[model samples]
Target chain A: MSIKNEILKIEHLHKAFGENVILKDFDLSVKSGEVIVIIGPSGCGKSTLLRCINGLEDIQSGKIYVDEQPVIQGSKDLYEIRQKIGMVFQSYDLFPHMTVLQNITLAPMKVQKRKKEKVEKEAIELLSRVGLADKKDSFPRQLSGGQKQRVAIVRALCMHPEIMLFDEVTAALDPEMVHEVLQTMLELAQSGKTMLIVTHEMSFARAIADRILFLDEGELIEEAPPEEFFTSPKTDRAKKFLQTFEYSKK
Target chain B: MNWNVIREYLPLYIEALGLTVKIGWLGIILSIALGLVCALILYFKVPLLQVIIKIYIELFRNTPLLVQLFFLYFGLPKLGIRITAQTCGILGLTLIGGSYMTETFRSGLSAIDSIQSESALSLGMKKHQVFFYVILPQAISISIPGFMANIIFLLKETSVFSAISLMDLMFTAKDLIGLEYKTIEALFLLVVFYLIMLLPVSLLGTYIERRVRYAAYGD
Candidate 1:
């Protein structure tokens, strides 16, 4: 655990929709290059947590810091914080109108105002990193689900984000396609990209995560190294959770 | 069956057809602009503009185009501001066409997932950039069919401009009838003129709709 210097910190965060409180007094801190994976049942606010960190959802009350810069609710510009953070959704949400190359180059060229030729060169390099260099001219519709998600990862990486948030990036893939997408993520994690992932893939989580956070119904129930969490979970909820996977596997 | 009269009036009919096409094309362009502005304002839920837009959409959509045309052509003159009949025609079509176009665009905008904007925002893009880059293209793709269909409706509705004496195709037919007493030939040629104008536009709309649908929905 050579982790030092926190990259993200959330304190006393509260989020809700109407009378239904989704997250309450939740807090977390992550160090640079720490691959934190979040596991939870459906509707347990796992995705909500990632969205809050990225400023997709406005927290009811709390403070979030990215490298000590506070993400204030309305006053601070989210663009500054978001530029360093990239998010990939379950659906890929690729801009269908854009070619793979254009999708990768858009935010960098448009928002960052980088020169087109330079950004496009970087985009091509990222596409090759994801093994999709030949698919640059293809529209999203032309790609299979696995290829689309891979391209999506490349699209985010083109922006040169310091941190990445992945919300079930492989959940929608066919069983055969899931591996390809996960392989891209595995390589990304190995490259030391700080990531906060909400996923159901236990095996992948075990392989890459530095720390695993178990959330149950809007509360952090357990946080441990993946080895310890898998072998000896501290809470009954986490035990039952691991049991379900065990039962499913058997 | 008055062939000679129709032949004699060919130039007048052509002139009227040209006027109708000019007014129709200009009005459609203006409406597209107005509709986009109004739709964006409503989509963003601008505090005051939201209520005003709702009233505007409801008002124009509910009432007849004739009433709207007359109001623009005749009603404004009574208020001591006189505009040309042609201006009234274009403005009337723009207002009415704009209302319908707004609704079409609204549906298109709503069809997109809010997550799309969220994704763009999380990528460090500004709100306007999110709109221009992420949302507007998708919205336009989905809205084109509806917008094109509305253009045909707007084209036919230009007949109402004749009420304000703007001398559109319908106006020429009516005038030629009065002069030559060849009502059937005049009216028949008018129908042919409208069909000639409308058929190509309708075909182009269908072609574009198919292409856009394939791009957006992958169907």
Candidate 2:
């Protein structure tokens, strides 16, 4: 894809927590409307990289350009940058005090400064899209795990962001509930929304991602289209990790 | 013992009780304000302010209200800051009430969901805005019972001001008991005074608790 068409450009990114390095010399560019799923061993900085994309985490030495806009070394524009991006976390992160509809409408009402009536209408519409329009008045604690994750997806979508970042959003859900969230994500991928996900669900990653990235120990060991990436991993760790199916079986 | 005396002193007794209400409300308002401000300082770990507030709370919480009242009314005058006994009551109540109030608010804040802060931060709310808008509105609900309890305690403690010559209800009793030498009548009048002071407070407290429960998470 052309540089003008790419939505996210990450170059020579390096980060560490004190002495423990997480991402080192990493480089990737995401084209508009493509889905990229990153999978790796625990503590490989997959989630950290997603966080840096939306300015949630600061990269130690390098740059992340979102919508061709640099995210590194800036002040409060991080919020403006963040306004263009939406993130869904592993915990669902829905405000328990708010009803599902209130949760969906909160950001749009506050940050976007939309009128209350308009946002409430939009919230109901978004809820229908996630198949929980009837649950609008329910608090988050009242919802099931699958229902909560769906609400979270719609909440992120309510902002109409150019890029959506998912950090293991389904990792906290039960096995029976994972399929509903994955289906919502699959439907989202079909909608041509630019997305970056760091998830442990390998088969879902294989089914939906345009490109699959495998990392181990802070390095991108392999990048390929799903069929080739899974059939033939290049690195020793990738080959061994996939054979063990460490995350897949679990 | 006499119906005529009960009727005659009834107006004066009621008058004294009204003064108790005024002082009690004033002291409560001041103490709650002081408590909230001090709790905020302690919550954010402000420089030396946290340490100072911590010691202040401990000092007040450990000491009796009468000693603190006498100290503020009589003791501080030696150092040139002589406050009236009424002012002494307000000050003493604030010092003591605020300590317990701070603890109540602190626990209320602790009961809040941690992600609520992160959610507020992600929304670009300033730190103070996050607390006031997102955290404290909900925390206020949790803290109301404790706040009302502390206020009731302060109202009851206002009786101690009679020792320092404040004209609050207990002081009126002191004067009446001395003037009439009617110990039973004076003591009995005080029982009514205490009931009137605390009854409304308890009822208001229960009302606030119910309202807050609805606001916090009631169906």
The TM-score between candidate 1 and the true structure equals 0.92
The models' CA-based lDDT, in order, is 0.89, 0.82
* Model 1 per-residue lDDT tens digits across residues A1-250: 4334788999999999989999988999988888999998889899999888888788899889887788865545778888888899998689888888888889998888999999989888888988889998888888999999998888888888878999999999899999998999999999999999999999999998999999999999999999999999999999988888874432
Query: lDDT by residue for model 2 over B1-219, one digit each (tens)?
Result: 666666667778888888778877888888888888888887778999999999998999999999988788888999999777777777788788889888888888878887676655555444565676678877888789888888888888888887887777788777888898777777787898799779987998998788777655635
The 10 consecutive residues of candidate 1 chain B with the worst lDDT sum are B210-219
Interface RMSD values for all candidates: 2.0, 2.4
In order, the first chain's TM-score in every candidate is 0.95, 0.95
Q: Candidate 1: where are CA atoms >4 Å away?
A: A1-4, A248-250, B178-181, B210-219
The top-ranked prediction according to TM-score is 1
Error of 1 at B93 (Å): 1.4
